[model samples]
Target: MLKITDLHVQLEEEDKKILKGVNLTVETGKVHAIMGPNGSGKSTLSYVLSGREGYEVTQGSAELDGEEILEMDPEERAAAGLFLAFQYPVEIPGVGNMTFLRTAVNAQRKARGQEEMSATDFLKEVRAKAKSLKIDADMLKRPVNVGFSGGEKKRNEILQMAMLEPRMCILDETDSGLDVDAMKLVADGVNALRDEGRSFLVITHYQRLLDHIKPDVVHIMADGRIIKTGGPELALEVENNGYADLLEGTA
Candidate 1:
């Protein structure tokens, strides 16, 4: 569903490059796990794919189902069936979670030439999805991610993904700060969304989360490049031996 080829990226104000010729393809009905140490440009790939500003694409192309997404704005990307569950979800103090989600969902539907959902319909659908994700109704009525715990925030992101139903979803460090229970909740939400026409790129450092989601392909990224690709066993190997051996050989 997504293809990234020879993707090179650098911060505009800095001379240093982050991603150097990184390439990968995620097909529909599969999940890809990108495991890398800190500063490996894993998050950069997510940001660049989502069209965040300040990251210059020196060379490369990211295509979603044969359409180039590098030229699209962030909202356009979302409307084109791309979703990014951030590593650290931002808090919008004044925006209630329900209000924010309804706005986003309606906006995407409106862009697609569909009529906006009525408040009652949106509430019913969102409540069902949120309940499936184990998000409390009270949380939905509060400000987005404001005063929420780390696990709560991650669960909220998953709730958004479930509500959005994007064709390709990128989960960046969704397990970063969650407790075991929260991790399971987040993983369950992702698993529930997995299907034949959708794909996921899960960026994480630990193998624990993969045990629940079970990625179809595992990739090891370093120095802004994907140096190794393997099956689920690769994640176990990395967990057991760390990135040392992979880095030594690649270096």
Candidate 2:
């Protein structure tokens, strides 16, 4: 569902390359995990794929279902079924979570030339999705991520993913700040969304998240490139040893 071909990215201002020939494919129904140390361009790949600014794709292409996506605007990318679960979900003090979700859902539908969901239908759907993510109605009434705990924020991201139902979900360190229980909850929400048509590219520095998510493939990234690719065992190796052995082995 997602494909990258020799993708090279660099900061527009400083001209420092971040992703060097990042070629990856996340097929339909598969979960792919990317584990790497800081500054290795793991997050960079996600940002670039999501059409974030400040980074320029100097070479190669990113395609979703054979459609080129790099030149599209961020919202257009969203309309095209691309979703990025931020490493840090920003707070919107003025927007209620429910309202924000409704707006997003309707906006995407409108962009795709579909009718807006009625209030009753939207409410029922949102509530059901929230329940699956362990998000209560009270939390839905609160401002988006304004006062949520770390776990709450992460779960909220999952809620967005569930509601949007993007074809390819790019999760950037979704487990960064969560406790063990919180991580499991977030993982459960993600796992619950797994299906024959959906794919996941989970980027993390640790394997604990993968322990619950159980990716079909695990990739080791370093020096702005994917240095090695393996199955779930790769994540275990990273957890047992650190990036040290992996880095040395690659060297």
Candidate 3:
């Protein structure tokens, strides 16, 4: 559902390039895992795809289901069915989790010219989703990730994804700081969202998460480019041998 071609991205203020000629395509109903070491531009690819500020696209193009998304704003990208689950979920001290989720859900609906969800209906739906994600009701009543633990934050991100139901989801380090139980919770939530029309691009360093998600394709990215692409076995190979072999000539 997403195609990126010869993508080149650089910081606007500093002329440092982050992604160089990166090409990738994620089809509907499949999960793609991007594994790379630190500073490999994995996160840069995510930010560029989401239309975040300061990343200048010096070259290439990104299309979401045949429509170019390189020039679209962040909100427009979201409204067009692109969702990014951040590596580090920010804390909103004053905003309750339920309130924030409702606002986001209704905002997307409004952008899509759909009727707004009433408070009662929204609560019922969100509560069921949160339960499936193992997020307690009390947690939803607290400020959005304000005082939550790392696992809590990740679970919250998945909960948001479950609520949004975007066509393509980019999960950046969604398993960064979670225990085994928490990881299973997040993975189950991700699997539940998978279907014939939905796709996922999971960016991570370890193979443990891949064991649960079972990606359809695995890509090795290094030094701002994807140098290798294979099946789920590629993730296991990387985990066993590290990125040394792939980074040698590529870097």
Candidates in descending TM-score order: 1, 2, 3
How far residue 232's Cα lies from its native spot in candidate 1, in Å, is 0.3
Best by TM-score: 1
Candidate 2 lDDT trough over 10 residues, lowest sum: 15-24
- Checking candidate 1 for backbone clashes, the offending pairs are none
Q: How well is each residue in 170-240 modelled by candidate 3, as lDDT tens digits?
A: 99999998899989989999999999999999999899999899999999999898999999999999889
Computed on alpha carbons, the lDDT of every model, listed in order, comes to 0.95, 0.94, 0.94
* Candidate 2 per-residue lDDT over residues 90-169, each given as its tens digit: 99998999999999999999999999999999999889999988899999999999999999999999999999989899
TM-score of 3: 0.98
- Which of the two, 1 or 2, has more TM-score? 1
C-alpha TM-score for every candidate: 0.99, 0.98, 0.98
- Angstrom error of the Cα, residue 239, model 3: value is 1.0
| Per-residue error (Å), model 3, residue 119 | 1.4
